[model samples]
Target: MGKQVVAESARRRRRPTKQGTVLTEAHIVETALRVLREHGSAGLTARRLGAALGADPSTLYRYFAGMDELTLAIGEELIGRALSGWLPGGDWREGLRELGLRIHGAYLAHPQAAVLTASRVSGRPREIEADEAILGVLRTAGFPDRAAVRIYHAFIDQTLAFAALDAASLALGRRARESDEERWESTYAKLPADSHPHIAATAGLLSARMKDSAYPAALDMLLHSAATQLAAARAADRGASGTSAR
Candidate 1:
């Protein structure tokens, strides 16, 4: 791990491509992102990345050990973009909510790449920084250390999990996506009310809402539940302290 970190740092310094284009690690990551966006996940091969950078595929090995490493780099870039220029506003709930939205938006913007890397643990600089920032916000909101850590883990995991799921839906082939939409409209909305009373009754609303993702509602529920837990913990602590005083 130490050696890999050192190598990553060195690669970020500078290098010259055979085509005379200066290739830094940043350039490689940026180009990789573009390739993922343009060609989709399967199109991110070393040969394709090399062609995009106007260099030999072997040139990429010097900066990244392999495609896995390069993929991690790209994932870190997505995380960095999500937290870029973000500052906590002291209200932890709103701060965390905004961060979640930013992360979700960034992933959805690069649906192909998000499907590839959203659930992977990069353990890179940006990923670490985002984790620390989230924990900090939770602690600032008066959560005890253990509670903060627990909530932080759940928050990050939930956000990434949803991002991956949504990205997968977005990354589906055009025909497949359309087919799903058509199913929701034609099949689901046409269910017999006698056989499936609930779904049939709400079929109209379901069809209208299926066009949008359910992430926002899910996120709100998670945050609300966490807030309730935090409040209960605080109340229990206060009661314990009063009892001890008596």
Candidate 2:
């Protein structure tokens, strides 16, 4: 009991001293982001974070209720960083593509955090801002509210999903990428007519296109289809509303 008391006293001293100091939430979130980038998800314990700032792990509790809250803060910070300097005054396709690229870049920048937070929607202020920004752009391009929301959902989901996949792909290093490509080519070469007839014939194109060469074109086609469908839906709604108003 005496030893336990002594250890507790030492821990108290290790904690931050300013019980009443104004600890900005942004600062805590930013620190968490740095910790994630430097150490990955496995290294971001509250104790380590506090020690990095010369504070006790309890100091983090003053800002966040728990680790889940801290994860939310970091997620919003990542989204907000992607949205920095983004303005909605251009072709809708260009705007949306730029937004997706920025998001992908941000996720790649802190892959450890991205791997952890990409699966959940935080719905925090920064996340709301990102959604609004995308929806606002789509609306200004003549999409109705419902169509705007639909396109917005698809756009955001694809970007996050692709970002997560792309980040995981990159962590494999150059050797893994080449080795995987070679192995794929080997199996594709062995595809017989009895198994995958069509695949065997175009195995060369299929293999090449299945890798990096096809993603950009496929992404563009998807975006084009989404934009066209959204536009048609908006026009239909407008026509219906006009007839009803008459």
> Could you give candidate 2's per-residue lDDT for residues 1-246 as a string of tens digits?
111212323333333344433345676677788887677788899988886665678766656668887898888888989999988787888888888888877887877788878878888988999998888898888877887787788888878887777766665566987877786589886789798998788888877766663334545776798778876877888999999999
The C-alpha lDDT values of all candidates are 0.87, 0.76
Model 2, CA-based lDDT = 0.76
> Per model, how many backbone clashes are there?
0, 2
Model number with the top lDDT: 1
TM-score of 2: 0.74
Task: Quote model 1's TM-score.
Answer: 0.91
Clashes of 2: 2
Q: Pairs clashing in candidate 2?
A: 15-56, 16-56
